[model samples]
Target: MPSPRPSLTLTLLQARETAMRFFRPQLNLHDLTEQQWRVIRILRQQGELENHQLARLACILKPSMSGVLARLQRDGLVGRRRMLEDQRRVLVSLTEQGEQCFASMSLEMEKNYQRIQQQMGEEKLATLLELLRELRGVKP
Candidate 1:
């Protein structure tokens, strides 16, 4: 028989859902969907990226990225430009409006993170992050 509370996938999903509960309201306040916010946040941090690179880093499917990007572009939150040296290579970046939105959201997100850290204790939170990175195969 399967042991209760022993499924890795289920535990991960539960953790994600719990965190999203806190973040969803913030996303709604910004009038942004999760995927849109993910795109904006990554663009804000990385400056410029190819659509595929952005999609991969944001954990968004490549097919879905085009639509997300289109909406963000229509909303004036993202810009797409072809490379001068390689015209076929399209690069994407956040616009000034996007930057402003990101800055505002970042403040609230950081506050939420601090709350979680306080609840869990800073050391435990750090250790959890370390273990998660290990599970994700990210180099320390």
Candidate 2:
């Protein structure tokens, strides 16, 4: 028989799925995939980044990032620019439309977070965030 202890990895995934349940519908309304949203969110928060850096920050593989970036550029949501000083470096950032998309969706996202806070209790939510960071070996 399996051990009484549940899998931590599976529990983390289930928790993520439960949370995405709230965000997914809002993402769908904008015709954005999870990957695209991740890309947009990172760019919006962190400003311009190279493909490799963006790939790392977004947890997207290099090949997948190419395709995702292509689709985003095609959709007018993101743009890649060559650095003025170093032509070899390419940086990616959200376009105006992408900013607008985030602006529009952020209200709903914040409201969902508020609901989650209400359900989990503000202190518990804060503790969970802190614990998750600690679990990742990150200091506050």
Candidate 3:
């Protein structure tokens, strides 16, 4: 007889779903989708970036990033400028408005993260992080 699958997969799935549920409400309050927030967060982390670099760092496809960039530009949250030396390269950065939004969302994100850490406890969270890195074929 075939052996039953391990329960770890289910546990991981449940953890992901629960975390998303917890974050979704906070994101909604910021009037941002998860993808939009991700782009903003990436820009904050990397400072200014070229369009292609932003797409890669955000882990989003070029086409999707085009739309995200458009929306952010329309909302006055981000600004784009052509590189002085390389006119073909379009650089993207968060505007003051975008920075403010990110700051607000960052606080909420931190709170959510702290809650999760508290709930999972430090040791379990550390173990989970190590396991995830290993699963991703990354050196932990």
Best by lDDT: 2
Query: Per-residue lDDT for 65 in model 3?
Result: 93
TM-score per model over all chains:
0.92, 0.91, 0.84
RMSD of each: 2.5, 2.5, 2.9
Model 2, global lDDT: 0.95
Residue runs of model 1 more than 4 Å from their true location after superposition: 1-5, 138-140
Which pairs of residues collide in candidate 2?
Answer: none
User: What lDDT does the true structure give each of the candidates?
Assistant: 0.92, 0.95, 0.90
- Cα error, residue 140 of model 3, in Å, equals 18
Superposed model 3: Cα runs more than 4 Å off: 1-14, 137-140
For model 1, residues 1-140, the per-residue Cα lDDT tens digits are 96687888899999999878878989999899999999998998888999989999999999999999999999999999999999998999999999988988898999889888888999999999999988999555
Better by lDDT, candidate 3 or 1 = 1
**Which candidate, 2 or 3, has the higher lDDT?**
2
In the range 1-49, model 3's lDDT, one tens digit per residue, is 9998889779888988998886899888878887788889999998999
Query: If the candidates were sorted by their lDDT against the true structure, best first, what order would they fall in?
Result: 2, 1, 3
Model 2 per-residue lDDT tens digits across residues 66-136: 99999999999999999999999899999999999999999999999998999999999999999998898
